[model samples]
Every structure is written in structure tokens, then in C-alpha cells.
Target: MPSNIPFRPFHRPAPDISATRKPDGSLIVRSNIPLGNYEANIGAYWRAAADRFPDRAFLVKCSPDDTWPELSYRTASEQSDRISSYLLSRGYGPDKSIMILSSNSFAHATLMMGAVQVGIPVTQLSPSYSLVGNDFTKLKYAVELTEPGMIFAEDGNTYAAAFESLDLSDKDVVTISGKDHGGIRFDDLLGPVDSVSVEAAFSAVTGESLAKILFTSGSTGMPKAVPNTHEMLCAAQKTLEHVSESLDAVNDPTRVLDWLPWHHTYGGNVNFFGIARVCGTLFMDDGKPTPGLFGRTIENLKRISPSRFSTVPAAYSYLADQMEEDEELGHAFFKNVKICQYGGAALSQEMFERMQQLAIKYIGMRIPFGTGWGATETTGTGTAVHWDSEKVGLIGVPTPGITVKILPVGEKLEIRIKGPNVHAGYYKRPDLTAQYFDEEGYYCIGDAVKWVDPDYPEKGMIFDGRVAEDFKLANGTWVSTGSLRLSLIDALDPLARDVVIAGHDRDEVGILVLLTEAMQKKYADQPGALSADGRRIVAPALIEAVQEKISRYNQGNPSPSRRVGRALILAEPLSVDKNEITDKQYINQGAVLSNRADLVALLFADDGSGGVIKLNKNNAMKGDKDVRNEQADTA
Candidate 1:
């Protein structure tokens, strides 16, 4: 637990919730607070924001030389109106959707709003689909599913190969720069506005009207297109607003620096529209949480001290590593930030304490660190941690206008959500739509949760691991991979970036560890750092450290379900093309395991190959005499 330092105050609404036990022992949770009237159309909020804060900067981005170029609300409105007119003149309507292949940018923001306001559904695909791989399989899948009438990319020359691979003969290609393949310049879209036509289209928009089509990360299989209606997006923002009363929003200086890709729900629906709903400024961060790219995020944080910092847990780990060594960066990041939030994965308790300690040291009070639970199927977040707390891993309670049902599944309680913010169905995939929902119309989210306090249901729920990720050993002992992964991450701390649990049908558990960049760099100069084949890192100290940590963990958790019996260090990076990793840096456990079945086999082979570390039945350290530097294939 963190020290007794007082938490910084934010006007967050208290958790007002109630629960009812069903006849079958299922628990239904609902928020007592009512969700008042909200905008039925997303465009209406844009108009209201533009009218109120016309001169205020709504979107900001970094130039090559580190200058911030901003787009004011009024300017964005005028340009979007022009874009709406141009789109309408070209006969693009609800069915003739546009596909955006670019990342988060001011231009992308304006174009999305422009098209959606006038009834043209826009599809945002991960740039990794186009730029990261040679096959472009996911990109082709998305194009075939959406059958878009137009495509937009930031640079035509950069994405020319991707466009060439796709059959875009009848589709229009729009680009901001590099006029390759006879593409239409994005600036050309800014034409004269037809107010009467635009007004008619805007007025015709309803809650059921399609606004955007977002694709899943394709971790399980081919990406499924999720339809975002005007009602879903608007109501989600309203629920978010009612949950967290931002001081920044009230003071008129709410600024956010974010790098989560706009293709995902967290970035696309929440951060993008949620910021706009509050009339706040979003500084589009181009940096990612990778080794060579995270420095750009640090530089952005140094320049723009935002009021709120929301990102994934992996990014927070990188930020913690940076802030621990760099005092100036820590001071700058904690200067104006009121709340720190995370989602997409569980944050380790060690990380939460470290961040709160840093906040107390620099800011005189601990800034409230929070998290929420949601998915692409749900508009954004159905439940959130809205109160001040010193603990981590609590997903809070149901937000207004949402209901969560907790049904017992084996030893875990599976969570299902029903709300106005939930999407109707997947685009053009009736089979998938029918398969995911229950007879009661609640979407089965496949996640498990437990009440913080069974007696006091208002305390919210703690995230138990994913129901599908859990697997039983050969002995029939079920292992909760979600909780186990977090435990391994906390145990490995600065050495391992992530660990994928192997051994589903085996007698015991094993882990494939992805080493942190610092760990690799720190041991690169040491003797015996590289394996005999120069494929894996076999530093004696690194291996010894890992063995000792896992040994201690094994001692602490002796059960077969929790104890790790063997471990292997993986050298290859997770591939975006293979769906092993998302753009937000979240590892897809199923994808990684299936994609690297050889590694999983090597982990359980017991031959001591590939620098495999093993522990005796009594949790004693196994001698490393046979732990050889076995060469393995890389993805």
C-alpha cells in the first residue's frame, strides 16, 4: 500500500450502485444515478462545441522540428463543413463509407467528423496492417468486409504499395502529401459548403445512424468490423462526463497528450470524442511505447504538461522506467496532470505504488490513479473507477445508463453488459452478432470480475482474469493466466517486459519471457551475453536473476495452478503482422502462443535447450550445467 499522503482532489462522482441476486445466483448491478438527456447525434456536440469555444484549439500535433500546430474549433468546423459538402457532392452517403488508413492526426480528426456528420460511415484501420507487414492480410480482410468507396492515407507514396495490393480501381484515393498513383489531395476536399444540404443530412441523423466502423485487433482471427452508431458514441461520452468531473474541463484548460492509436476503442471513441465532448485540447502524440519510439513521447510530455494522462499499463511501465532515471521528466509529467488512468490491461501493484510515490515526491499529494473496463463491442467504458483510492486493479462500478450482470462460470464470475451505449451488432456479420449476445440482449464480454467487498457491492469489482484465457493443467488444476501473468510481471520487475504462460496440457506451468530493452542493453557488453549461435541472450547474471526470482515466486505460491516450473527467454520481438501485439503494445497471448508453438514446445521439452531455466519439485534451483544456448527459429 502507498503511504498516507493525501490524494489530490478531483470532482469525481461517488459510486451510486445497487445489486440484485437472480434466481439462478446471477448478480445484476446497476447505477442508481440516472443518465439525463444526451445528444442523439455526434455532430450536434461538434456544433455545440464549435459555437461555444470557436477560438480554442481542439486538436494539436507536433511538427518535424517540435513545433505544435493546432486546429481551433471554429477552423475545424468550417473545414469539416466544406468536407461534408465535397463528400455529399460525390454521392457518398451512409452506405458508401470511407476507409482511413492513417494514424491519429488533426487532418484525420477533421475528416472523420466531416463524413460522420453527413451520414457517411468511416472505417479506421490500424496502420500496422498496411506498413508493418509484406502480406497485408488484415488490410485486405478489412477492405473486403467494408467495401469502402474511398481510402485516405497520410502519405500516398508511403502507402502506395498497400494500395497497389488492394483492388481499389473504383475507389477514390485521398492523400495529404506525395501525389502518387494520381491520388486526390486532401486539401481539395475543402470546398464551398452547401448549408441547406448539410443541414438536411445532419437533421436526418438519428441515434441508429452509423457513424464509424472500427475493426478489432484480429488477435483471435480476422478482424471483425464493429458498427458505431451516433447514439452509442454520444451516450458513451455522456456517461464518461457524468462519472468523472474534470477540473480541467471546468477551468477551460483541459489538455491531453496521447499516443494510443485511433483505430482502437480507447483511442478512437473515448480519447477522441471524449475530449471533444469536454471541449478539451488533444495533443496527438506520434510516439509509441517501443524502444526507439518512446523518446518522442517523453519529448512531448516535456513540452505539453497535460491535465490528464490516460494510456495502457505497458506505456506506464515505460514511463515509470524513464521517470525513475530522469527527474526533470517526472516533474514535467506530474506538474499539471490531475488524474492518471489506465485500461486495456491490468496494472501491477508495484507500478501503482511507484507512480504514487513519484507523485507524492513531486506534487506534494498523490494523484488518483484509476482504471475502467470496456471493449469495442461496448461503445467505450461501461464501468469505471470513479473515486479516490490507493489500490490498483479495481475496475470500479457500473457507470450511469449501464447494467452489469455477474454470472458464475466455474470458479469465476463472467461479466455481461447491457446498455444504450453498447453497439447493435458487427457490420455485415450476423453470425458473429448472434453468437456473442445472450437471449436477454446483454453482450458477453468474456471477462471475469469479483466484488471488492461481497457485503458492500458499491465498492465496485476487481478484475479476475479473462474467462477464456484460463486453462487447466493435465492434473485438472485450473490456472488463472490473467492474474498469473501480472504476478510474473511484478516478480520479474525491470528484467522482463512481459511473460506468456505456456503448458496448457502439461503437468506443470512454464513461461516465455520477453526481455525488457534495458535488460538487453545492460547485459549486452557482459561475457557470454549472446548464445553460442548468437540467437539468444544467455548472460549468466541475467539467467541467474530470472531463476532466483522465479524460485522465490514458486516458494511463495506453491500450488500447481500458480507455481511456475520452467521458463525460457525469447529474443524475437512480437510481430504486428502475426497479431502477436496490438498497436497499443498489448500482447495477444493466444496469438503469440499459436504463432510460436515451437517456443512453447522448447519451454516444456525439459532438455534444457534455448536457455530454459527449471526448478526442482522442492523449489530448489536446478544446476545450469545442461542449460545450453540452443538456436531457435524466429518469427
Candidate 2:
């Protein structure tokens, strides 16, 4: 094992900070920062970077429709000027909002910059929100919520139904094809570029101007539109530049192949802006992490050696699995990979270790795997682990110009942030915004963190869990769902794709697990626990696997809140349509528990109708499957 107990020796210099307790028993940490503030505006930064690296390729996309279509920094900036001109000629001003209903594309990026350049807020919807579901409930709600003056989709035909669903009498549609939905061509929209009008609008852009508005993953109720100001986006990027010296995404000319959607803050504010800020090249990979599209991601990886790259843990898990098997891909992946970042979910320790081993095997050294803790409200990456750590899930200290205050909440320390990167308010909801800030004006992000070592504040804090995701047992012990869920996934790897911790207001914790596709394939021939025709799975192996893992965990942890009394393998996968999972694959803890209240009850049922395996209270005892089997016989 690596001798560094909590953290490995960082490849880069990590920031050091000191924490002192306040009168309210809250801990406040500030970076030992020397760099002062700058003019916080992306428009100015883009203009400067274009002048610095005029010929550098800014956005790269392999086109099946045409030859190599690479947009340079100079070209993109000039086209965005045209885009600004188009927006003005049509009477779209700084106050009006224009929404994009498409994935990341060259056209999408140009138009987005165009809108934001002229002080218009751009809202991009997750394609799945509109295209995946039959009802288009979330899409309609989002459109109604933003009350956008203009809607732009790349292919009008793809979003035809969405246009019909919306009452677009007052709204104008911008599309390339000009689908019979009554709109002008996106190309035609750019032709009326009045220099006077465009320049006047550009000059009015400020740090406080609204840049974009993103919707939250609607796990609880209807999705709330998060308004991201230029200050938030600019400040977040500047924080990134301050902490990690090597990652001058604003100045460094790096290559990144990413598929993270621009609608989300991570991709938009971080990856998208990271490339745009420094005049780096971003190759938009049109592949997802699903079994079907994962090959495309690997293919993209083989083609480019990215200096920095990131995604959700699920994608990393998939890539790690492929790397272990494919030697050529593994070498190519880590050859130039100086930094590997993960966000969206708590990466399991198992994944962290597996990727480390793969890295060591291929490159003779391990790359620093970093992640940050923030939300859409923080405009993504408020406090990130800029340096290498031996482990995953270290949210690290506050980034430069950001202050992280840890307040005592019951037994846990709730994390809050006061920074320029923090969003001003939610769209059209002053009532909600008033409730969001604490007495100190720090945004209450609903997340909690624990000190890895109280003595060494600079070692950074690990993610404790989400405050909203935690619940109390019937006996009143708080269950930290985030930590426990990650523990279970680690203990039962290659079996559980995702897990939900249930049993709120109940005697003990229960686990709801979604199985990996590999398990079914591995046990296909045997008298496995799958239902007839392989449609449903009641995997006996998985039950035993989880029971063993939970029993072992309880033995080490010895806390009622930590002990899992029962577990069930759910055949049904978590749905993006229902907002159970975000596009980045982070689970909606509230949504899953609320949506599956019946299953939670089933887990505790004395009748055992839920396929739950009951473990004995004594930690060492083997799990009993008899309760479920006997109930089955009786039924």
C-alpha cells in the first residue's frame, strides 16, 4: 500500500489553508491566496484569447456530412459577432432569453456565445428532457419557466413535436432547416449583422450580466431554473486557474474530447468555458457512457491524448473496465493524461483503486484523479481538489476567492459557500432565493462534509453526504445515505450499477440495488435468479453478495445508522425521464426514495413479499433467505 495514509504525494503543489472556529461553532477556511481579482467578464476574456491565439483550433468536430470542420478562435469570435448582429435585428435584446434545444455542436456553441455576448441569457435543455419522454412534461415546464423570447434547435424536425407542444405565438423559432413550425433559417438570422448595433450591445455586457440559466435535475418537484451570471462563470474559472497552476485552461492550449452536455454547469461553465477561455481545442464527442455508445467514447480517447478530461463516475467506471481489458487503449488513455477529474457523483473507492492500478501498469505512474463539490447554484466547481490525492471524494479546501464555512448540524458539519462564483438567485423566484442563503449570506447547498483529520485542516475534507439525502431511523439515528451508498457499491462491485438507501422513519437501513448488465451475462446458463425469458432478475448471487458485504461493513462500523438490515435487487433501472438520474449519472436521492415508497415498505415487510434478504442483528451471522423463500411457498 502507498505509505501516504490519507493522501498520496501531489504531482502539483496543493493549496494550504488554516481553519479557525467561530462563536457559532462553525469552521471558516480561506486560501492563502496572493492573486487579486480581475475584470470578471467572459466576453472580454474571449476577445483577448482570440487575439492571443487567433489561428488555434477552438472547436473540433469530425463531420460525416462534410470534410474536416474545425473552427478557429478568430473565426468563432467573428461568427459570434454575426450572431450578436442577428439577435439584434430581430428585436432580441439584453433582457430577452433565448433557449437552445439541442446537444453540444459547433452551431450550438457559436449561437450560445452570440447570445451571451450581447448580454442575453441562454438556456439549454437536456435533450432527454424533451426527446426521451413521451409526455415532454419537463420540457414544457422548463419552457414555461424560462418564458424565453426565442427557441433554437439545430434540426427543426427533431424538435417539431416540442414546438407544437409550446404555445409559440409570441416566441420565434431558430433552426437550420426552418421546419414548417413557422421560423426563419438560423443561417438567414446571421446575415443582418449591423456593426453599430452589435458593437453597442457588446459594449454593454458586464460582470453582473445574466449569462445562462440551467434547470436543476427535477428530483423533488418541478425543475427550478438556476440563473448563472457572468460573474459566477468567470469567478469559477478564475478560481480554477488560481488553485491549479498547471491547469491554465484560459491560457494553456490543451486538447479535450468531451460529451458532457453544455446545458449542465460542469460541461458548460467548466469544460465549455475552460476551452473557450484559454483558446484550447474541444472535440465534441457525440457518445454517451451507455453500453451502446461507450465504444465511441473509447474510439475518441484512442484518437486524442487529452491533457485533462472528466466525466461522471459511471463513465470512468466503464472506461476503467475497458482499459483493464484493452491494452492499446489503456496506454493511449494515460500516456498524456496529467489530470483525470470526476464529478456528478461520489466515485467509489473500488473505481479509484482500479484506475490507479491501470495507470501504474500502463504509464509506470498514477495520474492525479481530482473532483470538486458544488452545484448549479455555484456555477459548478466552488471547491475542487486541484492537487493529487491518494483517494477519491476529497472535495478539498475552498478555491481562491471562495470561502467554505462548515457549520455544525446535529452530528454532521453542513457545508456552505460565500463566493463570487455563487449564483445571484434562481430565475423568477425571489421567495425561494431568500430562503437559499443562510444568516451569513452563504448559499445553503444542502451538502455536508467531514474533516478527514481535524488536526490537519489542509489535508482537505471528504464529502460526508448530502444534508437533504440523510434520514432518521425509527429510533432516531441519522443515516448518512451518500457515504453508505458509496460503501455498498464498493463492497458489491460488478453487481450493483446504482443503489438507493431506504428505511427512513424505520427501524434500520435497507438497500435498493440496480444490477450490472455483466452479472446477467456471466450467470446466463446456470439456474440463476433471473425471471423467465430474462426480462426480470431476482439474482440470488447478488443478494448473497450484498448481504455478505453489508454484514462485513456493520462489523467494522458498528453503528445502527450504518448497519443495513435488508437489501433488494430492483429489476427496474433508474429513469432519466423521471429525473431519477441526471445526464451525468448522479442519482436524485429524494426522487428515488419518494418514487419507490412502496418498495421501501416492501423491504421491511414481515411477509417478505419484496424479495428482501433479512440479515441477523448480530454482525457475524450469515443472511437468511428462508424468510423470502418460505413466504413464496405459502403464497
Candidate 3:
């Protein structure tokens, strides 16, 4: 009943893994493939890429007028050398870190490469911390913690408020524009090039040298500074290249057009550094997955057909909807894309099917959808789903250099990672470092997984849920929040953007859902239907649709731990400043629950108010005052 369209030529060896069981019911899984030799520093890869393809475009900036400015590998290397010489002349080193507060840009990349190549740790903070809120709390916190010697901003005038709020008396403020605000011009740094000094500093860079300090998403709390060493960054990409047979294919440079923020691990360490490793060209995408900005991404796609397309699950949902409607966009998307990759969350079966159908329609073949499982602490990715497959939630086997330890914890197997790529510890926070790593030096990542096939170990693992996120109801029935969340998303496809499960220590589970753009548009005609942010439901018809859908979902998942008893469409979007959402668009379940405790209380109260949609055992949607009153009296 399914189309037997073969996948495009994607060559990667089959998973070769072995496992060792411990006395405490913990299993250590590893790949038989070796990591082999890798570059000493991430900057070395950039140098090699320049040597391989001197005049090839290393980075391309998309423009509205089709004047896409490109920087060649040789030009980038030379400019980076000049920047490195400048930093060296100023006596910048490990202690004098460079902090960048701008979004992804050519100057940002060049500055990062220039600094990291010479052992000066560079910290790239999310622009949201500075530009999103008026308070600038997170920005101040990062400034206080990192204690950077120099701070870089794309525009000093745009971040004038952010700069005024911080103590920059002793720090150097550099900007590409808006120098009137007491900022140093970025162009002035290119006056001289100390070639001998630059070479000596670069040569002294060892595997232990700190290349970058990437901040964690701060989902649960304040962001932790994770120091990434040269070994970690270089080793991660090397393992992927060593294992993925087609990575360095002859005459095929890895070309990717991406918009993932460079502040995050997926964008910075993986995409940026990995592309440089294989002499690849990275087209800088100025757009994002959000509503107003996605048009830019589509425009960029129209001009440059990337070899690999990768993004978050939310972005895929948006793209799939757009491609289904716009034939030209679909054609442009699948024009030369060899693989479509997703991370952050699991893709729904419906979304996956729609993409494959679009691929079949446009490209005559199903492009392989690849995903991996890892975090900032693991450098980038520890496990990868490299093979061609349609199945979602398959995180695949451990990569060549990494080992995954699955330890039994209460009915779930918690995943811990260990490898050369893994971070030694948090930056200057030995307390947090000691708390995360175990006796065997494995970083306890706190994620849970299960075997896809116990008999066949190489079949890979499925994400169960976060071990810390799982909680018990009043009757002590444990709930796997991760699995339940994914199932609920699938059950409410085309309607729910994301669902956060709430019912810790309560009688039953309830879901706080963020509605999709399409769902909001469908109910836009009704007066008082949507909030100003277009997230809430004031219209009765929209509320009823959600109630009916979840009732059907509860029909199939009748178990206490699986079934959601009530639903509430969120009125307010997740707050980035409050740590409710990550830069990669991942909803922090714990942060949401903690910040919106009042909403959780209302979901549990269920006195038929606040647009809470409840369902009874008779499969009846109950929002009527009489029904709720009677139920409340009985309780």
C-alpha cells in the first residue's frame, strides 16, 4: 500500500556495536568502529578547507535583492589570521575570553575562528538574552559569569540598552556598526597581521585548549557554561566523518544552508565546525523557523539548493505545510537536498508521511530523514540514525568514539555518555561537574531510552522520556512524560504545536497545549477566539475541537498513566527569558510547569471554568456548568 521509492544514494555502514552488562543491571554500549586520528583544534579544519579549496565559497550571506555576498575559503582564512593576530597583539588568551552577543553573522564566524584558533575561549550568548526582554537579567547573569575581556555586538545602537545595563567600564566593546556609543570599530582590527605570532600561538594550541564556552539552554534553571575543548569539538566531527562513509565523498563538498543559532551546540560545534572539516561551504541563512522569518528561509532556498537540509521538528512542521501548498517552494526545497534531518524532538508519523509524499512528488525518491540524540554536554551528538529509514524516534547506535551506558532506574533505563567528545565539566563550576559525572566518568545525561529490539542490539534505541521529568500520580502510577507527550502530539496533529504534561502528585494527567499556526488561522473568523499572541482559545468551537480530539486519544490510551484527563490551550507563549524555551525551539517541560504553576492548579481544579476542557468515561465532553457542578459536589 506504500510507494516503493528508493532513497537517494546515501552510503553509511551498518551499525556495528557491542554491549557489556554490569553487576548493577547497567549496560555499556559502544561502537566497534574506531575514531582514528583527528585534528588537534577546530581551527585546523578551517585551515585545511582553505588549502583544499582556496577560492571556493566558504560562507554565503543571503540577501533580499539576490546579491548574496560570499566569502571564499582563502579569504576567510586570511581574515581569520588577521583577527587572530589582532587578538594576540592585545594579549588575549585563555583567561581573556571574547563574548559575542550577536546572532549568526559572517563577522561572528570570523571572530570565533580567529579567537579559537589561538587558544582564546570565545563565548557566544543567545541574542534573545539581550534583545528579547527589557529586564536583561539573563544577559547580566552571563556577563557576570563569563567575565569577558571583550564583547562583540552586531550593532552597538541596537544593543545600547543591553550595554548600559552591564558593567563594561573595564571591558572592550567592539561592533560592526554604531560606533558613536563608545564602541570600537570591528574594521580597525584588520590593520596589521602578525603572521609569526599567530602561527606560534596556533601551534601551541593542544587538545586541552578551551575553544569555546557554550551555554546550556537553561531549561531547568540558569544556563550552565560548558567549556568545549579542542579535543571535544575536533573529535566529534572526526567520528561522524569516520563513520559516515559518504561525508567526504570525492568532488562533493558538503553544502548546507542553515539558520540554527550558532550559540547552540547543534549549530556551532556540529554544523559550523563539521562543515569546515570536509572543506564544505556553509550558506548563512538569515531567517528562522518563526512565522515572519520563515519567508526568508524559503527565499534563501530558492537561490541555493543545499546538499543537506536540517532543522528542528517545529520547523519541519512549518516547512511541510508550506511545501504542500507551494509547488515552487517544494521543488526548490527538494531540488538538490540529499538528506533531511531533524533534532530537538521526535517527528510525528503524519508529518513524516507528508514530507515523504512531497519528496516523492517533487524528487521522485524519498530523501533519507536522519536524526541524532545528544546535548551540549556531549559536545554535539553521541548517537546517530545514519541509515535510511522512515521510522521516527530511532536515535540509533552510539557513534564511533562514544559509549552509551544504559543504567536501570526505577522501570526506565537512563542514558549516560562517555567519550573524548564529552565535556570534562562545567566552566569553573566543579560542584555541578561533580554532580553530573558518575564514578566511571560518564556524564549522567538524565535521559531515558529503551531497546528497539533486545535480540538485535544494533537496531538502535527509542527515546522513552527524561528520567527527571517522569513523575507519579496520587495512586503512585508512574508516568513517562516524554513518550506520553509524543503520543499526544501525534494524536492531536495539525492542531497542537506542543503539549506539556501536568499532573505530578495529582489524581490524573492534564495537558497544557500550544496550538499550531494552522489551528489558530482556522478559528480566526470567530470574535474573541484568539489571544493577542494568537495562542489562546476564547471561541467555543475551537475549544470543542480540541476536546473531541483528546477524547478520541483517551479512547485508545485508557491507562491511567497514558490518558490525559483534561486539556487547556495556553494563552501565553513560552518565555525565552524565563527559560521556558530553548534557542532550538525545544519546550522546557519542567520550566513550563514551574513558571505556570497557577495554570496547572486550574487544570486540576476543573470547576468548569477558565476554558478547561474535561472528558468523562462515557466519552462525553463536559464543560456544562451543571455537569461540572455535580462532579465537583461528588468530589
Backbone clashes in each candidate structure, one number apiece?
Answer: 0, 2, 0
For candidate 3, report its TM-score. Answer: 0.95
RMSD of each: 2.4, 3.2, 3.3
Q: What TM-score, computed on C-alpha atoms, does each candidate reach?
A: 0.96, 0.92, 0.95
Q: What are the per-residue Cα lDDT tens digits for candidate 1 across 183-252? A: 5889999989999999989888898999999988778778888999998998898899888875445465
- Candidate 2 residue-wise lDDT, 81-144, digit = tens: 8888888877776578899998888789888998898888899998877688678888888888
State the lDDT at 336 in candidate 1: 88
- TM-score, candidate number 1: 0.96
Candidate 2 residue 368 Cα shift, in angstroms, is 0.6
**lDDT for model 2, on a 0 to 1 scale?**
0.77
Better of 1 and 2 by TM-score: 1
The residue-by-residue lDDT of candidate 3 on 1-635, one tens digit each, is: 16578887788878899999999989999999988998897898889888888998888888777688889989889889999999999989999999999998889989999999999999999998889888888889888888999999999889889998888888988998874355478886665789899999999999999999999987756789999999999899888886565665347777898888899999998999878877888888888876568888888887787889999887777887888898988888898788888998888877788788898899888888888899999888899987877588788999999999998899898999999999989988999999999999999989999888988879899898899899999999999998899888888888887899999899888999887766655665465565443444645667777888898889998999998888878857678777888778888899898988877887788455546777787667776563334334433
Give stretches of model 1 more than 4 Å off: 180-183, 246-252, 524-527, 532-535, 628-635
